[model samples]
Target: MQPTTPLFLQKFSSNAPESKELQRLTSFENVENKNRDTYLDMIRIFINRNHVYRRGHVEFIYSALKNMESFGVQKDLEVYKALIDVLPKGKFIPTNVFQAEFMHYPKQQQCVIDLLEQMEDNGVMPDYEMEDLLSNIFGNRGFPLRKYWRMMYWMPKFKNSSPWPVPSPLPDNIYELAKYAIQRISSVDVQSQITVYQTKEIESSIDDTWIVSAQAPSQKDLLKNHDLKEPVYVEGSFRIWVKDQLVNYFVLKRQPKQHIKTIKDDLDDVSNIRTPIFSFQKPIEKQVQVMQSVHEQEDGVILAVCATGTSTKDSLLSWIRHLEKDGNPVLSDALVVFTLRTGTREVATVNNVEQKQIESK
Candidate 1:
């Protein structure tokens, strides 16, 4: 015999052939629609293909979990439940305490646990039926059931908790997205008015896109009172998410005025009171000064906020013109500047905006 073989070098059974279930899932890459029906159909086919023993289910589920986003079903609870139901009932459950603690059917249990983790990541809460499925597949002591319990306890508390609630399954149209974005942005002012304008209506427009704008009545007065010589700026390629979509919006604003912060309490001042000869003291109603509005903040005063179909300079020029026509004719004399930036991260000044205005004139 050859020299005594090292224990580490001893031959072990070679790994088994590639899993057919995984191969099938890999082939699903050709699918284009990525809709719910297509995803469920694939699951049905897999179940039928492995009808008898449903072997390789652990790998199949892992593959399915990975594919959920592509199928646009990652946030869907029913799809997640269907994924959990793939496991055969009463099969992986441990009969002994030792088995339960050690993680009975380690591969299968771990696989389902990972699936539950995916659901949690996607903010998908499992329902009572999912609890029952986990109980049947991995029993009471299973880690996945514990994960499910934790999720049920926490998810509902956070759900619908946002004060600025956008519609679920956010609208696909960019105009609709822009409206929702403006609505959220305007939540700071209860009296904010949202108006939609078309660039085509602006005669000199180049980029044909919709503009959704929000401005309160107070903001309009602020614009009217704005110094005509001091140029107001169009600021931003600023971003906000309408659900999953990235929306680019711009603000019409002015630099914050530097003023001393004053906190004068009138509570101690009794100078305005007149002592009535007959009965009691009567206070004369003094004329109150018109205070600066909520829009007038330490930061720039926001005149108006808008999202345009094309966030390009041309569309913004059109937005300025639209504002001029809508009640604030003072924009006719007020010079508008642009602080638009380019893709190369270069900040562009008013040259382009001025040029566009000149060409329009």
Candidate 2:
């Protein structure tokens, strides 16, 4: 059977309002003097005038409903029903304003729950969908669910077509059970490894009329001298494992280099020392070399890695971990380190390196 279009979508025409009309209607001040019915009509116009319900319109409607009392416009049950009916389909509604406005009154609290129930009853959202949304709102806010047990009861009813019956003698306190379920649903696993290495630069220092060679500084000396025109390598390897199996691994490295120059006493002296200008090509080339060697040793096994700041790295790691939780591939027992800044670098290890699995949620 063909599914029916959701009522929220059916109430509106596909044609969007002209830019001038939308601009005028969106200004809440323009309708401030109008009666409550006019405000409700404005909401209906905003919903029906657009082909797709814009988030702004939904937010505006929510804002108006929340501030109806302050605006000296008492909203009736009909108005609340209309607002619920016109809510944007398949989108998250910001609940802060609504929660603050309605939380003080028991009747208003029931009204908000009723509106959500109506949306589910009208086929706008499935049972599980509504539960997920409500769970986020209630669970995150630490709202007591004793009065909203009906909502909690609705959670176990929909099991994605499982033939198994609901557990008999369900926990006496279903709210606690629901909270646990929500936590499990929302939890995630993250696996990360950070490797830091010290590097040194081998170069020559110039003096007046003389080219003097300087011995390469040790790692300790390079770290101590921040003004040195040398680079230090910080490499991080992140692997996300779910359900006790490795799904993804990421490799990243960064080198910080700086150069300093001194104005020679005699510009005419070609041998005079000049400030060093650092180049990143060496570090990049060395990283590429290490990657190539690792790939060759592993027979072209490739792990996805991105280079960015710590925030982006964390976001990607979290996103990949949350995507899927079941996989079969075991993490390989190989460790690769690219220490281009220092000589005698160990590029790859086949069996020498130990493999550890990390799970984050």
Each model's TM-score, in the order given?
Answer: 0.75, 0.23
26-47: candidate 2 lDDT, tens digit per residue: 5567655666766676666666
Position 211, candidate 1: lDDT? 91
lDDT string for model 1 (191-227, tens) is 9999999999977678888899999998998898888
lDDT on C-alpha atoms for all candidate structures: 0.77, 0.36
Q: What lDDT is obtained when candidate 2 is compared to the true structure? A: 0.36
Prediction 1 global C-alpha lDDT: 0.77
**In model 1, what lDDT does residue 214 have?**
96
Each model's Cα RMSD? 10.1, 25.6
Misplaced by over 4 Å in model 1 are: 1-22, 30-34, 49-55, 95-107, 262-292, 343-361
